[model samples]
Target: MRKEIFSKKIMDWYQANHRNLPWRKTTEPYKIWLSEIILQQTRVAQGLPYYERFVGAFPDVLDLAKAPVQKVLRLWQGLGYYTRARNLHRCAKLVVRDFEGHFPNSFEGLKKLPGIGPYTAAAIASIAFREPVGVVDGNVFRVLARIFGIDKDIASDAGKKYFFSLANELLDEAHPDIFNQAVMEFGALHCLPKNPKCDGCTFSKQCEANQKDLQSLLPVKHKKLKIRTRYFYYFIVRDKNKMLLKQRNGKDIWQGLYDFYLIETSRRKKTAEVVKTDAILTKASILKESRVFRHLLSHQKLLVKFVELKLHSTKEMNLLARRSELKKFTKPEISNLPKPILIDRYLKANP
Candidate 1:
């Protein structure tokens, strides 16, 4: 029954070539969920070490639930998308408080938790608990779309539904755990988005897209991303060896993460233009107007410029400081503080 549509050769390839990751070795649902969350917006190579660190530090779901939010955010620093970390912490607490520190055994139950969406729940349910469900992440979507020559825009709801139905048909329920993993791994390693090695691929002969020479063009997306351009003016205000660091609050990226004094503008402003509007810049000594750092987000392009300001006295710095907007961190303390990648880059180079 399993052999009708499911590929046995892909399982063989998975057994032979799958990376020996730490999370894969564990049968614990907590560890599996942790790995999935870390790898959500992250890559395998970059996420592996963070996974190991998290597993070691928390050790159990109970530990993670009891740990401070700051501690969790610090551990998750530099991972980007701080919301994942926050939700992970929140989910842990909910599990502890509601479910008695046990993850939900079923996909629907898992989705009720803070950050466990359909893809994540499916991965955890099938891989950890042997539930008969298939994951349809970006990798899985790519694999199914290419092998079956599916030309529908995968980003659409209809396309996702069609692919999920096809995936359900191909899933070997008796071996759901290995089947889902194999399909995702096949996409990640062999049925690549770019230049896939179709000549050596096990499914090359049977693959529809490969036969049609349309692997690169098959998995289409309907909506073009609307990338907005933003300008940020960062003031690195320093009084002696102490500098101001502020925690990002409100509905914005890098919440719970620390960064320097920030002033966001609709358009990039020249130093002369910025100085005329603000009296502080006219009084404070502008050390250097650093080079513009271009940062690319999923839907935004940020052009950032850093200006270092040195005050004459401690009183002068204190007078200008907005306690709500700033907190002073010593030179040594700055190194210990976790910051966004943009700020971190500037610190390392300048120091």
Candidate 2:
């Protein structure tokens, strides 16, 4: 297909049908970068409020850089992939300290910042800086593969290279920002992964997938994720109005988020089996036990049980805290502390 014709069709469709998102209306690199990062592994509907909240709290790069990490993570609560929030904070500081609060204007320069990969850099460069580059996200990948009929495993390095080259080849050099957005939006709205709207598509006749009836087959992605099952027994030790909570450390899931005294086991264990795992819990009074919560992540399946235990005196609470390496937090204090969604949801329902 002719690059001009292809780009023109996409841009025309975009101008008429694109959603009016706040990020699309601006040329500020900071806001653009924020939107891109939030939208990663997230849908537009889910990421929209987070973008608004982040902008409301920290309007610019310097504001984000100077704010406490806890504050950032707090604002980023309930949004999974906590690493993105951490990286967003780090990148903001790098931009402020190194680039004087101004994001790098070019793709290569933006790629130097932490968490800014090639796709993010390309997006910021084209949308904010008007660099002539195409952004190949999942949306773009599906669009290109189906429309152009290129059958390469999107997970493979060779497949990625081919699509990357094709994206640059089809890029509208004069208006890359519009072309990129148009194509991405086209795929998101029209050429869906499951049931694509092929009836009224602009490229209905030209699309290989539409003609060949293979929309689901193209854009082949082979992902081998080893889903590990984990069992968590969380002890919610409470002393009157306060509860003992511990911040997760080390390189594991929910790092830095606050949760209760946890006892992890190889498999599912009963309450008696769990109590035997920790000696500190033997001193406390077991009050209630929550039903099992089956939480699913991309690569992990967690079966969690929260056990509520009440300590008789402040001294006992202190002893539990000392032995368990936790701290006492009032109800209000616990509300302010960052927590994993599982912990937060359990608290909201139980409290």
Off by over 4 Å in 2: 225-351
TM-score of every prediction relative to native: 0.67, 0.67
Clashing pairs in 2: none
Highest lDDT among the candidates is held by which one? 2
Cα misplacement distance, residue 80 of candidate 2 (Å) = 1.2
lDDT of 1 by residue, 23-72 (tens): 88987999999999999967899898889899989999999999999999
**TM-score, cand. 1 vs. native:** 0.67
How far residue 200's Cα lies from its native spot in candidate 1, in Å, is 1.5
RMSD of each candidate relative to the true structure? 14.9, 15.0
Worst ten in a row by lDDT for model 2: 276-285
User: Per-residue CA lDDT of candidate 2, range 1-351, in tens?
Assistant: 788889888899999999999998899999999999999989999999999999999999999999999999999999899999999999999989988999999999998888889899999999999999889899999999999998898999999989989999999888989998998899889889999999989999888988998898988998778999999999998877788899999999999999998999999889877887666677667899999999999899999999998777888778878887899899999999999999999999998
Model 1 ranges with Cα > 4 A deviation = 1-5, 225-351
Model 1, residue 236: displacement in angstroms? 33
